[model samples]
Target: MINEVILDDFSLKVTSFEQGVSTSSSGTEAKTIRFDFEVRGGTEYHDVTVHLYKNTFDVKVPELDLSFRGTINNYSTSRTDFTNENSSSLFRLELIEIG
Candidate 1:
């Protein structure tokens, strides 16, 4: 099973991970990487999204020996408020290849 993902400087332990390809209008295919993980607490949530949003990342899957430069094609979280220390939510991130 795909367990972990490295995005930029963050090493995230994922609950699920997938690699895919998408064909554009020009008929060129590009790699698409997606994963699901959990984020807990307000501080942790902020820490994770602060530098990642709207930025290109060096994505890596060490076990599969795959790496690419990509940006966040999609990002979603289960909860918007994580002020409670015990708060936790699932996060899904999808990265699309640059070229």
Candidate 2:
């Protein structure tokens, strides 16, 4: 199974992953990557979310031997705040290649 993706400067362990192609209205196609990852600490959750807010990143999925300049097409988290100790959050992210 594919378990990791390097997004910008952070290496994340993915719980699940998917890869596909997306077609635009003009019949152009682009690569798409989606994954689910969990952050087990409040500080970590804060860090990951900060990275997610950036406009674009260099993404690499080593198991698939794929790399691209991508942006977040979709993103979601199980919770809003992770201030408490021992907190954990499940995050789903979908990225589409733009370069």
Candidate 3:
């Protein structure tokens, strides 16, 4: 699990994080990391979009002592159920490492 993720000048305290690696028959390998977290009190959608628009960015996971140069392969956000008024906006980010 990753406790924190640093993307360029922005830092997020992630609620949950997962990382995976896969290899194809041709020996090509891919490294990916996914993060699940929330943003509160502001327009999180706009803020996140601006930072992730870059072709590539550096990600640092302090808990794993790992750094990756990656691209944003996928991203999604969903508002919390209406019943849970206290819940914050949930966001998911998936990044694939580049060669």
Candidate 4:
């Protein structure tokens, strides 16, 4: 479980989280983190979109004690239930450690 995720000036309430590292054919490795969040009731979709872009934000995971300035490699969204108005967004973030 991710204890907390801080992105720029906002703290997100994540529903689910996953993180891992992968190596490419050239043997280069990269870290990735993904989280799922729901936007319902009073939240505005535009507000969330404003904070996400190709490579425009910083990320921090407190429980993992990890900090990285990274990019949004992939993102997807879907409705939680077709019978309701609730929706969820999934964000996949690729991280690069700063020295």
TM-score of each: 0.93, 0.93, 0.77, 0.69
Best of the two (3, 4) by lDDT? 3
Q: What shift in Å separates residue 3 of candidate 2 from its native position after superposition?
A: 0.9
Model 3 per-residue lDDT tens digits across residues 1-44: 66788887688889889999867577888788899888653465
When 1 and 4 are scored with TM-score, the better candidate is 1
RMSD of each: 1.1, 1.1, 3.7, 4.1
lDDT of each: 0.88, 0.88, 0.78, 0.63
For candidate 1, give the lDDT: 0.88
* Candidate 4: residue pairs that collide: none
Output the worst ten-in-a-row residue range by lDDT, candidate 3. 79-88
lDDT of 1 by residue, 1-99 (tens): 988888887889999988999888999988999899999987888888886774688889999999999888998999988888689999999999886
lDDT winner between candidates 1 and 2 = 2
> How many steric clashes does model 2 contain?
0
Q: Which regions of candidate 2 fall more than 4 Å away from where they truly are? A: none
- Clashes by residue pair, model 1: none
Runs with alpha carbons beyond 4 Å of true place in candidate 1: none
Instruction: Rank candidates by lDDT, best first.
Output: 2, 1, 3, 4
